[model samples]
Structures are given as structure tokens and as C-alpha cells.
Target: MSERVDLWNNGNLVQDIFLGEIKVPVKVLRNDSFQAWYLLQPRENGNKSSKTDDLGSLRLNICYTEDCVLPSEYYTSLRNLLLKSSDVQPISASAAYILSEVCRDKYDAVLPLVRLLLHHQKLVPFVAAVAELDLKDTQEANTIFRGNSLATRCVDEMMKIVGKHYLKVTLKPVIDEICESPKPCEIDPIKLKEGDNVEINMENLRYYVDKVFREIVRSSISCPTLMCDVFYSLRHLAAKRFPNDPHVQYSAVSSFVFLRFFAVAVVSPHTFHLRPHHPDAQTSRTLTLISKAIQTLGSWGSLNKTKLSSFKETFMCEFFKTFQEDTFTESVKKFLDDVSSTESKEPSGVSEPVHLKEGEMYKRAQGRTRIGKKNFKKRWFCLTSREFTYHKQQDKEPIFTIPIKNILAVEKLDESSFNKKNMFQVLHGEKPLYIQANNCVEASEWIEALCRVTRCNQKRLSFYHPSAFLNGNWLCCKATAESTEGCARCTADVPADTQIEIDGDRETERIYSLFTINRSKLQKLEEACGSIAVYQGPRKEPDDYSNFTIEDSVATFHTLQQIIDIVEKLNESHEKYQKKRSSSAKYGSEENPIVGKVS
Candidate 1:
């Protein structure tokens, strides 16, 4: 595959001409990952190798994983084990934990695992379980989920899978505007060009930040229900994790949603497909400033820790000073609360859900744990904020009561599930409570009523089975498993919230990766220096490192050490992640599993 780039100065109105391309063999990347900087060789038609220096080198982090997955029948043992994760406490000992342990990176394992769990509607419980375990180890609430552990990665990937449309509705337009109407936001005097105005740049930076932050805070309704549910779980978990710290509730949600997700996407819009191409350098600087400000405000715990003194650059410090207004912080807190809110809201044009909604319906209970002959029975049903109950007759003792919180999803039941019309399913923790309304309108009303009351339920499902489980298999997909996920997605009032799929890439982390990729180049340079000193002749193999020098060697090395010691703490992190990566015992045996499974 080849990547091509062209540089034309649209702003300068100067005749610009620069083209570069690079290609690699298919064999090198087959069923594996390729990550490193490649020389941005000048366009040489179809040439694979060309020694060219005019165009700068580009860092390419690409992975191509092709798995020869056998048919579903062949993986029954493994699939069955994995689907039973909810039943496993601590979640660290479960099959899902082992699945991540075997992967080279959690990123690779998270997607398929989340997709599988979400498919089975088993993701919420596992998430809550793992997060609870993660909380136990969190000595400081601010540092919760700071590491790119499996639980965090699972939620991150889940958002990416479902929140793409969320990102579109929430931040894409603002991102598009910023990318198109380029602005010069470089305020540092050393880096500024002759005509650059620091004051104007600062104003533009503030404007962009205000716009983006405004859009985000106003987009509570657009947040996805799955994300909200996950956030709801996180907020409660964080509060319980640090009972004394009320701010942990806000921090836990914002740490991922804003600091990690939204800010990262704003900084690199191209990666999330919000923009067609990478922004110009000036525009990128504008975005980077905005992202920094947003992250600072989002850091509710860090607010107490750093007090906004985290900025090292004097200009950035000055820039953040402009946000001394309390509105920014309030806005951030409100947005986090809204995103993580589990308090059910009445859907528009629907008000009776809060007070009461009582009707007659046919009821049948279905679940994996059931062990009895079942039949549909006509019953009078009533729903309220506290509980959903059904009695043998109206105004009489209730036969059964389903706590409102227990309700996970209220979706249209597939006719194929029971061969009866006007039927719907109410899925909860214990079993599927099948209800049949009098007619289609009545069914719709009941379903809507149940959903409105349980809309903010922390464990509400993103999807559910449309068809009923019959005999030993699901009629919808013909899967033999009783605990299989629904074949259809559930309807929701919340729009998709956000999709900021950012890997943990701090400034030092990026520098460290670049240094690692080019460590061989540095070694080669040392050899070239040694050879020339001994041979006393002209350089034979010219090194390509001469062209890129944004900093001196001593300063660069000093920055690198800081990358390890200060910013990334690379040495300690590497040891933790690489510990027995090849051994399953590193995570622990299935009989004795470890929490926070590392890669």
C-alpha cells in the first residue's frame, strides 16, 4: 500500500508544489501490525525505494489482522466460557479477562470482545464488575482508569463502535468549520513567524474553545444511551471508590469523555474522519490550544491537584487565565452530569409515565434459568417510577412486581417469538418478561411507557432480541444459546453522544515512540561517525537525520529523559504491560485470576 501527500499553500497564495509517496510490500503487513516512521520519499512513479530528502518523513502506525475464524459451531467451548463472564465475580478471573491477556495489545482484543458482549447484551454487567474491581485498587480517585486497562479500553471501543453518529451530531460541524476556516493560533514568540500576532492568536484560540465547549455542553441530548449508561455506572463507581470525594463522580466521566475522547478528536480531527485531511499547521495549533483548555476544565480532580497551573508554556498559562470565569467549570460539570445521568426523563409528548400508566396485558416469563412449562396469562399491569406490577385483576393484590431499575430494555417483541401479534419484551436481570398488549397501539404505549420510566437505568440495553427464545434455540438467528443477544437494536430517545477514539498519546509518549522507531537510525549515525573518524575519508552511506532538527541533540536527549521520567514514565509502564505477555499465568490461571489483566 502507498500513501500519497501533496502540499499546496492555499493561504499564502504562493505557487506551492510538493508531492511525496511511500509504498510497502503486502507481505510485510500480512496478519500483523506495522508502526514506525517511513521516509516520505518523493513521488518516483511506482518505485518502492527512493532516497529523497525534500519531503519530510511521516510516522505510520498501521495494523492489518486477518483471522481465519472458523464457523460458530467450532468455537462453542470458548464462546460458552466467554458469555458466562457476568456470572464470574471480580470479572478478572473470567474468560473475557483471559481473552485480553492473550492479545499483544488491549486495543486488538477490546473491539471483538465488546462486540461479542454487546451482541449478547452482557457488556454492562461486565463493565460494572470490572470497574468496581478497578476502584478497589485506586488509591487516589483522580488516577482512576488512568491506565489503558481492559475495562477502559472496552468502554473506549464501545463508544467508537456506537458513537460515530454521536460525534457527527455533536462536534463534527464545529470541527469542520475549524478545519476549513484556518486560523493562526501559534502564540509562542519563538515559534511565531514575522507577521504572527500573539494577541489575535489568543483571541482566536479562546473563540474556538468557547465554540467547541458550548457545542459539547449543549449536546447532552445527543449523547448515546449506551454511553450514558456506562457513564452512569462510572459516576456511581467513582463516588463509591472515593466516598469522601464528591468530585470523583464528575472526574470519572469527564476523564474519558472530555479529556481523553473529545479533546483528542478536536486535536486530530482527521483520525476520526471528521475532516477529509489533516488541518494546516496553523489550524492544528489552534485546535491543540482548544484541546488543552478543554482538558484542563474537564479535569475535575486535577482542578484540586494542579489548580490550572499545569501549563508549562507561559503563553498557554496566559491563555488559560482568560477562562477564570466560573461558567466554564459549571458548564463542564453540568455536561458530565448530563452525559452520565441515570435519572429517567419523560420522552417528549409523553407525561403519564411519571404519574401512572395502568392497563391489561398478557404476561409470560422467559429466561435462561427458567425450568418449568410456561403459558401466557391475562393480567392487569401498572407502571410507576418505583416499580412495574401486575395483578390477577385491577385494584387487587399484585402477583409480581419488577423494580423500575431492574428493567433493562422495553422493545417490540418479534411476532416470530410467540406467533402472536402486539407482543413486546421487557428484559431485566433475571428473565425476559414477555407482555402482550390488547393491540398494536396499546403495545406501543406500554413499550414507550416502560422505556421512558427506565430510559436512564444504568444497565439499560443497547439492543435486544426481537424474536422469542423457543425450545433450545433463538428463533431470530437460530442460535442454540439461550443467553444470546438480541438480533435487533432497541429504540432510544438519546441521540449518539460522541466518538473520540483516542489512544493514550501524550506529548512525551509520541516523542518516545518516535525515538524508539528511529533508535536504529541513531545507532547507524554513531557507526557512521566512528567509521569516518577512523577511515579519514568522505561519508559513504549518507544519513537522513540531518534534515529534521526541530531541537538540538542535548536538548532532544534531555526531553527524551523527561519523556521517561516525567510525562510518560515509560520504563515502569513498559515493564507492567510487557510482564509475561507470552504467558497466560501472567494474568493468572482460570482458577486463580488477577484483576486489571495487563497485556
Candidate 2:
């Protein structure tokens, strides 16, 4: 029961008009799959007497067949079969391989397969095996792991799922800064604004590329250990496959990390939650220039100077020439070495500070016991990944230090509170620190920076008074009590840490369902395996197992027989379970809710 709204003006939700919604019972998803046009209805508890206009229906396709997973014992047979995938000789014949072959799309099969194997700590061997097979099919050393094979998709999915936090802590601050305080970095001659100098724009683009690149390389320690392990496997397997090429291993890791991970993040920062929304036209051009430069720099090892010629625009080629130094190449190599290491990639507990925002601003002192105009003093303010601090002067210290974790909320101050034009407040456990920026843009920039960094803080507020607490009361809400809850709800409360937990049993069950749907194709695959095993003459031009890759026929046939047996047994168990469910839940109730086309 939620409404989607437009995110604009520093992640603030504005013009949030009410829309229709659909309410489906939780139990309706228990062991049932449905596709229906659920009619839209008015908000149930919203103002009852209000005459709401009619909203249209919505087509929903639900895949939640199991609301809760069965106990561990129920999944034992399926679990054992998946765990022994590597041991099954000629990995192409294994259940995992069969799933990849029969499914129309590789991703549908790869998701469940990767989760199951990774969950049991048996992923590397299978990935290496598939990658080796993929390499044998390739003649050129340059094109390894470029195709969307099972091995490639598995690693791609793994990086995205595991590296959620890595992307956030590494790039979010820079992305926020770029979006908030935008400068003209558009270098194209046709696209330049009136005062946009080509050299200045190029320098700005380079500065951003350097900042993002530095953060990425130095933050390898934050890379998830699982990602490092998978990358290590890809690196070794690729080097083993192409023993002549000295740089194949770097390409193997960079193919996914830089080309897929960092480059894509830079191009579309909002998708990664680095930006609150898509950047304006000029900002987007800046990001595109930066992203293109990064992609080339990251590809330093494999392609060498060859990829520089791949740039389209004449200025782009010129702009990219700045990164030809050996230092940039070395940085890419070092980053690859760090990320693909087999050792523990854990953080050292001491957080390094990456600067987010800074400027001189007027701060009204938190005179909790007293209030006066003399407390307002100009101070040098600074923000970083760890803490926010301000000093008496640009070079002087001995002022204030507020940990970012304790920042409760930051909002604009009531203009009437201090008769100031560009004022805002930093709310924490103590009294609010009211500050006045030089202008509106700087004010919004500071607010956006603080809010983005502390978004994941557990103690962050859901609401805040948009005005100042002055003269013993909140000016905006006119609330006399200091602790009274805020009248205005807070915006920009997106969760800090993304949770992408994969249930092992549920994934195993999903694999089972995929197998059940393509059972006939599975039968054909088995027959093809048998034919390839027994036939010893001139093979047919269009062979039986041509659709599926059969590396070793006898081995594949043996594995397929075991798979068919397990699926049949599971099928019987499912039938018995279905009978029990239908008998017990004939009448729809809370235990087995029924959902259908609504009035």
C-alpha cells in the first residue's frame, strides 16, 4: 500500500498526489502462482467522506509461490545434488549445466544456480570449470569472458549483489558532490555554454575522474571477500587458459569491475543510489565524459594504447591523452592485484576520511543555557566520510567535532527566525546548530551532502521542524514543548545499507521449479547425451545434443540419470503436499486466502 512519487530538488519528494492501490493478502501467495488484472481501489483508511475519483486497474504477475520456506530436512535431497555439481565429471553434464542449456534466458537460471553454489562455498570450482570450457571455444586471447555465458553472467550477478555497500561507501560522496554543486564540464564544442572554457571543462572532468579513480583503488580493502574470491578464480583460470598473454588476468577482473561495475555506476549514478535523481543535462555530460575516461583507464593493461583510438570525438581523444602516464596504468594494475587477492578483504575498523563538502559559513552558537546575536561567528566548515567538523579559521583548529553517525536531521531554518536569507540547521542530540550559507545554492549543497552521508544512520529522524527552535519554542510548528514530535515529515529517508539476502532453500526450490517446467527438454537432453555416448561413427551434421553443450557424453548421461531420479521423487512429494493443502484449505480463510478480480 504505497504510492510512487517524483524525486526532485535534492531527493525531496514534491507534488505527491495520491494514487490508487491494491491490497492482497499475505497468505494468497502460499504455494500459488497467479497472473491477473487486480482492480485499483481507493485508500482504505484515507478520509472516508472524501469523494475520490475512479482509478483504473493494474495487471500484476506474481511469482511468490511460497510465503515461508519448508524446514531444512525437506530440501536435503535437492541441496546434496547441487553441492556435488563440481565433483560430477565433465561439468557440462551436471544439473547446473543442464539448467543453463534448457532455459531460454541464461539469467533466469544463473541467479538460483549462483546463490545455491555460493551459499555452500562450492562456487569457485564450477565457475572455473565453465570458464575453462568457455575459453576452449575462443580462438583469440583478446575476447575471453566477453560473451554472456553461464560463467560470465554468474560473476556479473555476483558482483552486483555482493558489492552493494562497496559502491555506496566508495562513490556516493563524490556523486552527491557532483550532483549538488554542478559545474560546466561539457567539453564538446557544440555543447558548451556561453562562458564554458574548453580547458576548464576538461580540467573539471579530469579532476572528477581522478577523484573517483583514487577512491576506487584505495578502497579495495572494503571489497567483499566473496567478490575477491570469485575474482581470484576468474583471474587464475583466464591466465591458465591464455598462457602466452601476460595481461589476460587483469582483463578478466577488469571486464566486470571497471567495464561493468564502476563505468556503469558513473554513467548512471542514480541507479546505484549515488545520485538522488538523474542529473541535469550539463551534469549528465560531465558524468559521461568521466565515465568514458574511467572505462579507458581501467582497460589500460589488456588493450594498452589500442583502446584510445576507440574514442569517438576529437576532443575526447585529446582529453583521454592526459591519462597516458605510466602511473595511471600502475594504479589500475595495483587495484586489480588488491581486489583479486585470495586473502581476507576486511576493513581495519579505523575509517579513512574522504572529503565530501567544505566552505565558510555563519554558525549561530548552541547557547543552550543562553541566547544572543554575539554567538553568530563565521567558521570554516568541513565534512568527510567519518565526521563533520568546523574550525575558527581555514588553518586554525579548536572548535567543534560532530560524528556523522549522531547527525539526526538537517533542514532549512525559518527565514523569520534570524532574518536570514540562506539559513539551515544541523539537528543532533544537543541543540540544533543553525548556520547561514552565502547563498541558496551553497545552502542546499551542504544540506544534500550531510543528508546523503548520514542516510543510513539508525538514529536518523523521520520528521523535523523546517523552522528554528527560538524564544523557547519551534518557530515553524509553534510547538511549545522541545521534545514534541515534528509536525512536518522528513524526506530523503532512504535506507543506508541495502539488504540482498538470498535464501538457500528458496533458491534450491526455484531451481527445482525451473527443472520441472522444462522436463521435456531435460528428457531430450538426456537422449542426446546417450547418443553422443554410444555412437562411434560419422556424427550427424545437426546432432541430437547440438542444443546443449556435451563436453563428455558418458559423464553427462550418468549425471542426467541421477537428476531425473531426484526430480521424479521431488515431483511425488510435491503432489502429496498439494493434496494435503487442497483438502485442508478448501474454504478460503486467513490460513489460505483467496485473491481474484476485484469489484
Candidate 3:
């Protein structure tokens, strides 16, 4: 006889099938309330053969309905299992799918989980999984994943693990999205009145411009495409508004400096030197943007030459004055030359390279050189008239020194197999010492300066080689040698006029003196107008204010004003009390003549 087997869920019989078909797949009811599973068998009977002998059985490991509510403990256990087995391929995929679902609607809840994944360097897989899921909350999940701090950390970690190229492809879109969000550029209207309104506005503009450029720089380190977008945005803004407003002019000009600084920093972090080797494509792109920006500024300046000339001069002078002591002075000078009008000539007099006697320092700059075959390191180079010495950082004694007299020739090397473009080889009796500069211009400057100090002809330096200026078939004159009847570019054969001796050192000193005088007057004005706060404390004040001190100057002024108001109020109250006391004494005397007589 045929017998039936039944499966019960929470005391409700959900499924019935023939007992003989126990090996076949059984379909059970799908419901949240279904908790337990049971199997029934035919009761033992005295027949020829019974289809099933067992009377009852229990089934474990049954899957509940998809809508069934899971306990917190069950979820925790599942998550733990998933995390523990994350290294396994199938388990990892499953975990990612489940975690994505869990975090789909509740991002805040799963932040801890996300942090845990980031901590363990497992975020990429999870992010990849979430990216693949076609869920309604995918965009939200992506946003949560690319939240600023988290996204930065994730990108940093991915860069370390998967490298910059990989992260560039994977995370660049996210960075672009983050950078596309606009920041508030409002300035404090109150501060605008306390100082020169133009200066105040310029400062605010500079701060915002710096903020935007810094973000662009950070983003461009990996994905260079964003730089074009940032450049285009700035150029657009500057072009549209620069002609109408000085504030826009100031922003455009300041942004040009900012871009130049960033470009130099990217190519040469040690001294911000813009050498030929600094990723040509990127550097060229940045420099092109800067040139365009500067051209825009120059055009505006030219249009409003009479009105804006003072501002331009002051801006350039102040910028140079601020960074005069830094190695970037030369770079800034080059930028000024590029952007400034022809009428505004930089101090053109060539300064005699300072010659040192004994311990006197002629010049000092940061340089890098190879000590051995492959051990290249950066060092502090100090030049004296007698010798050029290099030292390790913070060392009292020099690691190496080359006598000025021993130097035969200083020649710039071409881009070679081992040496870079900004390298100069000093021939000191056949023991060639190769030194590198931050950029081609710096290298040329060093060579020229060294030539002058060593009593060598500066024009004879390798950089001044005629071939250096050749552009393929054309000379520096822009005429093709084949097309021209004769080499008219050969000016060396022509007798030149006598060289005019202009004291560049004296002119530079004069410029600096003027700058110092103007700076002092400005400082005095700032102090007088309460733009700069003066502390009359017991201790002596510092000549240069600390960053914190400068930031607190305005607040300190406001606080002093508050204190003065409070003191005046207290003084008025004290005067009133004194008047009341005197009146009371008079009244007491009038009331009692005996009391007055005792007094």
C-alpha cells in the first residue's frame, strides 16, 4: 500500500508527498511564521512490506521564507562568518551581496562595517560588489562610499595596494564628483571695513583661489584630467569678470602665482624648481594654463594701465618681497617677466655673483648630486669664492668640497641615459662632478654664476652654445638655414657695442630698500588703523607675529574694545556710588548735627 509523508511548519502541515519519494526534492510553504519542519511516516503494520517504517522524524537546516525576520544574533553570526571567510572567493562574493543589501537603505548603520572593511583593506572588493549590484540605493551607497574622509582614505590605501594607475581609473570619477561640489566663498563684511576694502577683498579672493587650486592639485596627482577642468573653470571665470573688476583681476593674477607654485612644487618638491624632467606633458599643460591666465591679467592691466598699474606693481612687489628669501624668487621673477608689460622691466642689471672671503657665504641653495655610482641624495650646497662645499643636513662639517680653482669647466649635460636634463657636470681635473638643479633655468643660472665667480667667461658656458637654441632646421632667428642665402643669425661675427656696466647688486638693493620702506609704512598704517593689534603687555613683543598671533589680532582688538566698554561702565557706576555716598553723608549731617560735630 502507498503511504504519505507530511511536513509541518509551526504546527501547520505545509507539505505532503509519497513516502517512497523521500529522496526527491520537496517544496515547502514559504511564510514568515514557518519555523519548524517535521516528516511523517506510515505506522508499523503487519503487511508483506511497509513503504516506511519510521513513525516520526525531524528535519533541521531548513531555509525559512525570504521575508522571515532574522534575530539580531543570527545576523551578527552571519556577518561574522562572512567576515571570517571573506578571503574565500565564493564566500566573499556572498558576503558582498549581503552586506550591500544591508547597507542599501541604511548607510549610517553600516559605517562601522565599512570602516572595518577599510581597516582590513577589504573595501575594494565590497565596493566592487556594491558597484555591480543594480539596486535602487546604488547611488546612495556610492555616495556613502565616496564620502570625503572615507574616500580619501580609501584612495590612499588603494594607491598603496593597487598603485596610482589602478586607482586613477577606479577612483577618478569619485574624485571628480567630490571636487565638482562648490564651496561657499563668502567673505566677512565686517572685516572689509576695518582694512582697505580692496586689500580685504583681495585676501578673501586669494584664500578661495588657493582652496580651489589646492583641491585641484591633490586631485590631479592621480587623475590629470581634472586639472584641465579646473584650469578651464578658472580661465572662464577670469576672462568673464577680469575686464570689469579689480577684484577679479587680483584673483586671476594671484591664481596665476598659485598655479605656478603648484606646478613647480609638483615637478620639484625639494626647491620648487621647474626642470625639464618634471613630467613634460603635465608641467607643460599647467604652465600653458598659467600663461593663459597671466595673459588675461596682462590684457586687463594694459587696458586699465593708468588705474591698475599701481595695484599690479604693488601685487608683484609684495609677492616678491614675501618670498624673497626663498629659492623660488628666481622662478617668480621669470613669471613676472612673462606676464608684466614691456614698460615694467625687472631690475635688468646683472649682479656680480657675490664673492666670499674665507668663511663668508657667497650663495647657498639646495641641490642634489650622486655621491657614488647610484647613491643620489639632496644636500645643502654652500658656495664661497675659494670653494664650493656640500653638507648633510644639520651637519657642522662638509661631506665634500671642491676648490674653485680646480674647476675647469661647468657644462650642462643633455638628457642622457643616466643623467637628467637639469644636470650640470663640473670638470674638476677630469674628476667630473655632476650636479642637478631644480630646472633648466636654474641649471643655466648656476652655470653662469659659477662661470663668473671662477673667472670664466659666462657666455662660453655650454647652455649658451648656439646649438642649444636651434629648432631643427631653423636657428634662433626663426630662419631656415637652407632657405636663407647666408646664415644671418650669426651675430657673433658682428662687432657689438661696448657692454654697459650696470650694478645689478646696487639696483636690487635699492629695490629692496624701497620695498622695505613701503612695507614699514604699510605696517605703520595697519597698526594705526587697528588692522594690526599691538600688545602692550609686560613682556616685549616679537618683531614678527606668529601665525596664531596674526589670526587673533582682530579678535584681540575687538576684545580690547569690549574691555574698554566694560571699564567705562564700571567707572560710571563707581562715580554714581560715590555721589550717592556723599549725598548720604551730607543728609546724615543735616539730619543729625551732633553726628557731624563728633566727626
Candidate 4:
């Protein structure tokens, strides 16, 4: 008889028993319907005694067929039999149920067995059972499977049972615990040392380095230095470890921590002014780490030749803006200026330094202009009663002033012409007021006469700048108030009622005329004729005051001549008038000779 392995229910009956021939290999198949094992003879035919020596006898596998339907009582009996086995055995009853359910494609039964294993503190076995068999409805079942309800649960239980913790902390908490634990087994750092003998116990070094590296890097922030060391360790320990495990490889690839730390320590501070002196220290440390990582990665002999290339590419790309904008360009300019000025270093033949315009560099206090440029002065002006005075750009305090003399003749330009050049050239083209004074005597008389006609300032004598001639020339004159012996025929066609400008450049000028035409008499004459129909015909022949129906050139001419006579009288006898005014209580005396003919 061969040795028999029997598993029984609490009812003292064999639920599943294994028996084979002592001399020959015997195959066994369990019949679920009978809850008994059936011996299926092996392929080799030999005497029973020789079966004991057959190597195939020890390699037995139990199989169940699809058509063999087991009673529910038999499944229950099998479960009780496994549970009744000795406690020292690591065999799982839940695993048995899970296996049977999987072979039968019973997902509903498998989920319950998963729950039973979760209850028995066998989380790894339960997870293994779930992983070993493909359940049609695994996702639906896992929704209800919370992890073990304790903080100190094993890594296997904590990872699966409380998947929420991993999701919440992003697995950082677990990685931190693995690193921070005092136990040597928690994280074996020796395997990650740079100079471990790799050929002897090669598997142990690779295994320990990979295992420690995996847990360390799952969350890098908790143990950044350790993360760097493990990667360096792997680089030295085995060529096989590079490239494929980038999660570990990238973390181990030296520069990873330096890049991340640089972003926070250097980049964040310079951009946001986040940290003080501490950030400076961190920056130095980061640069050192980065250099080491680059050197180490460059020395590697593996497919991750691209890893070294990619590290450089990624570092350059990630920090390009910071290095170029914030650090390299600005600092280089500062350093060049400092060295060139202080040390008196001669320029190299390679390249000359370029200068910057104002408001270019950030270092010289925000919103300020840079070192060198000329300061521009504001233009200044002053106004006088007779004229406007402005400093010429070439002249200093003593300004070259301009006076708006008598407005030659005020005239408005056509609206079309005014719109085209905006009246800027109007002053340069034609003088506004035009007039002539007899001598010094006639000039004073006419000045008063103009006050009556225009009703403007009584004493001021000036025209808007550049519009009137300071020298009182005929061509500069716009129109005439009275005739002057020197230039009597000078005449200009001036439009009426155009506005004049007087500011900074010009003073307000009091207008004085040598003659005044009575508006009422002119209106009466136009009314008698139906129209002052000058320029009525298609050819637009010239018309004069003589064309009126009244037909009194003498009356028209006399009216104008009387006004002129009054001005002349005043001009000729100003001293007499002045003397009489000094003597009289009233200005227009009854005996005043010039007053009687004027009215």
C-alpha cells in the first residue's frame, strides 16, 4: 500500500482522499458527486513493485471535469474538511473555495470566499487568490472589499484592504513608513551602496536593491536622498537594472531629485521671493547633486544611454526659462560689468560686451531706468499784454520773442481748406488784421477809432504770432482800416468774424480802426433795392457800393470820410485833446471840435 493523504469533514467521513499504487504511479481524480477520489491508472504499464521507483508517481495533479456536477453539500463538506486541518498548516480554506469557484466559473461563490479570507487575517493569500484566477466580475466584487481596519497591517493588507489610503496620500505614507522604520529589514540600505561585490550572491544584491528602491521611490518626497542613493547603487550593482524600471530608474538617475529640488528651492524663491537665505543653501546643494547625477548617468554602460540623454534634455527643457531669464542672462551681465570695472580685465578677442538701453535689466530696482541716457527739458513760455513770448529751442533764458502786431485783417479760411491742414498754415499764409497809420499822430488817432468799431481792448496793440508782421510791412498786412501815405494802396480780402488764438505765444491785441461804416445806413440802402444784388449774373461781374438803387456815392463816401476825419482830427490834435481832458470834468467836451462832425 502507498502512503495516503486524507482530508475529512468534522462528521468523521473522508471528503477528499489521495491514494496511489505503491509500485506504479496511479492517477487520482475527485468525483464531486460522490465526494470520493477515483484512481485513474498512469500511462506506463509495469509491475506494482516497480511503480514505487517511477519518478512520475510523485508528480500528481488533481483535476475536475466540466460535466461532473458536484452537489452543494459536497462543496460545504470540502470547506469543513479544510478548516478542520491543523492550524500550523498555512493552507487556506478560502483559497480552496476560491479555486473551486474559479474552475466552475462561479464568480458569486468566489466573492464570498474572498470575504471569508479577508475575515481570517490572510489578506496576502486572498489577494493572491484573486490574482491567480480570472473572475468575470472582479471589478464589481472589489468595490466592497475594504482593506484591513488597522494602521499596522502588513504591506500586502494595507495596500489592498485600504486602497483608499493609497489613493488619498498617493501611496506616500506607505513609502515613508518603509523608509523611516528602524528595522533593517524595512529598508536594506547596504544593497544600494555604490561598491557592493555584484558577482557573489548577485541575485541577493539585485533583489534587495530593487525591493528597497521600489518602496523608496513610490513616494520620492519623503526620502529624496535615499532615493538618489538607491539609484546610484543600482547603477553600480547591475547593468540589468537600468532603463526598464524607470519608476526606479528615473528616481535613481541622480538628477531627478536635484531637478525637483531646484524648481522648489531656486525657481520658486527667485520667481516668487518665497524663501530667504535657506533657499540659497538649497540651490548650492541642488547644483552639486545635479552635477553628480549627470556624471554618474553618463558613465553607465547600458541601453539607458538614452536615459543620460533624456536626463539632460528634460533638465534643460524644464529649467530653460528660469536659467535663461532669471539667472544666466541677468547674472552674466552683472558679473561682466563688475569684473570689467573693478578688476580692469582686458577684453578677450572672442566677443565684445553689448550695452543695454534704459529699463532693460531687472536688478536695478523695479520700474527704474538703466544707467545712461540724456534727460530732456520741458519747453517754457510767458504771455505779455502786447505779445506772446516763448523761448526758442536754440536760445536760453533771454528768449527770441514774437509779437502779433495789428491783426492785418481777420478772415476765415474755407471750411474745406481749414479741415485739410487744420488752420495751422492759415496764420503763415495771411495776416488777420491790416491797417496803416498816418504818422505817430495818425497812428494814435486810429488806435482809438478802432476801439469804437471792434469794441475790443482799448490799449493793447498786438496780433496773434507769425500771422502779423512785426515790421509793419504791406505784404504781411491782412487788411486795412485806413490809408497810410507810405503804403496807401495795400489791400487784402479778409473774411469776417474768424476766431483768433492768443496764448503762451501771443497777447490779446486791442483792435483800432481808422474808419467805421455805419451798419444801419448800409442795411437801409440794401432794403430800398430789393437786394444788394452784387454778383447776380452768371458771369458774376464785380459789384461796388455805387451799384445800389439809392445812387448816392457822396452820401456813402461821406459817411466813411467823416469817420476817417474824426480819427484824423484826434490824431492831429492829441496834445490839445490831452490838455483839455486834464482840464475838464467830462471827456467829450461841448467845445471839443472833433466830436461835432463825427455824430
RMSD of each: 16.5, 15.9, 39.1, 51.6
TM-score of each: 0.56, 0.64, 0.19, 0.15
Question: Please, what are the lDDT tens digits per residue for candidate 1 over residues 207-234?
Answer: 8888888888776655666778889888
- Tell me the whole-model lDDT of each prediction, alpha carbons only: 0.67, 0.75, 0.36, 0.28
Tens digits of per-residue lDDT, candidate 3, 555-596, equal: 433333332343344345545655665667755463223332
Q: Which ten residues in a row have the lowest lDDT in candidate 2?
A: 6-15
lDDT tens readout by residue for model 4, 96-212: 321331232333233333333333334333333332222212233211112221111222222232222212233233223322341222112232345544343233323333333
Candidate 3 segments exceeding 4 Å error? 1-80, 84-93, 99-105, 134-203, 215-599
Candidate 4 residues lying further than 4 Å off, grouped into runs, are 1-110, 125-160, 171-303, 306-599
Candidate 3 global Cα RMSD: 39.1
- Model with the higher TM-score, candidate 3 or 4: 3
Model 2 agreement with the true structure over 202-287: per-residue lDDT tens digits: 88888898998888877765566556767888899888888999988998888889888898898889777776555665677678
User: Which predicted model would earn the best TM-score?
Assistant: 2
Model 1 spans with C-alpha error above 4 angstroms: 1-19, 22-65, 301-306, 345-599
User: What's the C-alpha lDDT at position 241 in model 3?
Assistant: 37
For candidate 4, the 10 contiguous residues with the lowest summed lDDT are 505-514
Candidate 3: lDDT of 158?
29
Q: What is the clash count for each candidate, in the order shown?
A: 6, 0, 1, 21
